[model samples]
Target chain A: GESVGLHLPTLSVQEGDNSIINCAYSNSASDYFIWYKQESGKGPQFIIDIRSNMDKRQGQRVTVLLNKTVKHLSLQIAATQPGDSAVYFCAENGLKGGADGLTFGKGTHLIIQP
Target chain B: DAGITQSPRYKITETGRQVTLMCHQTWSHSYMFWYRQDLGHGLRLIYYSAAADITDKGEVPDGYVVSRSKTENFPLTLESATRSQTSVYFCASSSGGNNEQFFGPGTRLTVL
Candidate 1:
């Protein structure tokens, strides 16, 4: 599998630690945002999403926080495990007309150290 | 075994040759998409289909063609393969507007 993490920012965390991956998106008009995870040689997988009207959303072991004022979004993973290691991406559906599709970020590689 | 799937997980071809990448989804999602992932650029949409017999171009549609004659199959064709087109291609599907998209494993196409 080809690695999409080349030349990308990396966040290394210790096992059982909390890891936060941050993203700054463009497009003040964008209303929907999502987080995706992609392992080496694999396609992006949907992890969670947030609508513009909401400020925060939570999942099993993940939490997505959105700040419209700063156009910032963050994914907080609790008790990170080795299986959580992968490249994470933040996407927004705030394109000019919303006709195109989601605009994805470059991605962040999460390296979990035992 | 019932999900979005892509064919020819790996392909290698020459320049100026015609190549077609197949995408099929059993979920019967109304929306389908084709994207190419590069190093610096994450994933850029190449083309998409809203439904059967309906298709549209995306950010980078040049040198590519797509057709969705059936509700479950959307195939992307490269009229003339070029070295610059070498990238991992991904196909995705969504139930409807703004819904989460399910992706296939992807096809690694290499143009020589």
Candidate 2:
């Protein structure tokens, strides 16, 4: 059974618009969460990560918001571009800090419509 | 290359055959992991090693074996390949639990 999953299987956004991808987790004890961007024919690449203690974290053009109260996580890409089109995955590391590896969700395919 | 790599990017084998996938990382990370990715199921961990000679089972470990005799290499073996074992395999390494895990390109395995 998958403990983490996305709200939608696909998301389409205009090239200049913002893109939001959402994920939900079943484990309340999970502490660390990560967002990965996986381009076709390649492996998953780490985009950003947030710990349970933090509610939000931002990177270059990506922002990750964690809502522990609702057991949800989201990744927002600002001013999406064509190169941003890819499959995004959300992963969780339990209380052990991921010594056992990460639990990943199916993923959400992001399409940048020009 | 100074990054993680997997051998035989694509492979096809028959059922009941023994197959081994090799993973090598140059960073000498302390932790290495093996995962299988299917269409519907994202990445599911098969086995992980904290360090050389220290291995543990992950979410789905059946029919798979892994050994980390050296810190830089972790190989996964399937005793008897099955059709269900056909999937893309990925290898990842991290310095520790809290660090980011760098993944290999991936190996696509098909069992006929």
Candidate 3:
């Protein structure tokens, strides 16, 4: 099955610069998308989420852009900090019914270079 | 003290042995899910519970059993452990179908 995938496995960025992570999903039925950050030895923590009706959403220091036409999703971290170093994953909530589950991408490891 | 938690944080067992992983959440969320994380596979859902006494299979449910008698507890049991089952297991809970899910620290299981 053609599932959600990331263009890069690892992304390197300077401590004070901006960072962007890209994800591509094949399921056009996915109307909801979410970004999660998992630090070392920790579970995934929600970063931000966006709906198909909107093109962009912003959080404390993160922003998610959804391109429904291309089935592409991107997470932008402003003023990237060392704490932002972690594996970022994008999940699509397109499943129907009560037993449905989200489809996740392989994830992109974000490394903050000091 | 008030979030989702998984038991035995770490577990190791021999193949063919029965193993049960425990997941508990204090949020009292209506939805609970189990997922296994492997090298190539990011995260695959094992099972999910919509509410008390209601459960369903997810991406991979073979060789596994799940029971959700209570809303806050969802336990995953492996009838016969296998080396292929060695992976990081995570439990998550959500308020609703479209809500964001909160995951536990995860359980690293090793089936020798």
Best by DockQ: 2
| TM-score per model over all chains | 0.94, 0.97, 0.97
Per-residue lDDT of model 2, residues A1-114, tens digit only: 439989999999999999999999988978889999999989999999998899999999999999998999999999999999999999998546689999999999999998
Residue range A1-26, candidate 3, lDDT tens digits: 65788999999999999999999999
User: What TM-score does each prediction get for chain A alone?
Assistant: 0.90, 0.96, 0.94
- TM-score for candidate 2, please give it: 0.97
Model 3 C-alpha lDDT per residue in residues B1-112, reported as the tens digit of each score: 7799999899999999999999999989999999999989998989988999998888999999999988899999999999999999999999998879999999999999
Off by over 4 Å in 3: A97-99
Docking category of candidate 3 = medium
TM-score of 3: 0.97
Please estimate how well model 2 matches the true structure, expressed as its whole-model Cα lDDT: 0.93
Q: Rate the local accuracy (lDDT) of all candidates.
A: 0.88, 0.93, 0.91
1 versus 2: better TM-score goes to = 2
For all candidates, state DockQ relative to the true structure. Answer: 0.61, 0.83, 0.69
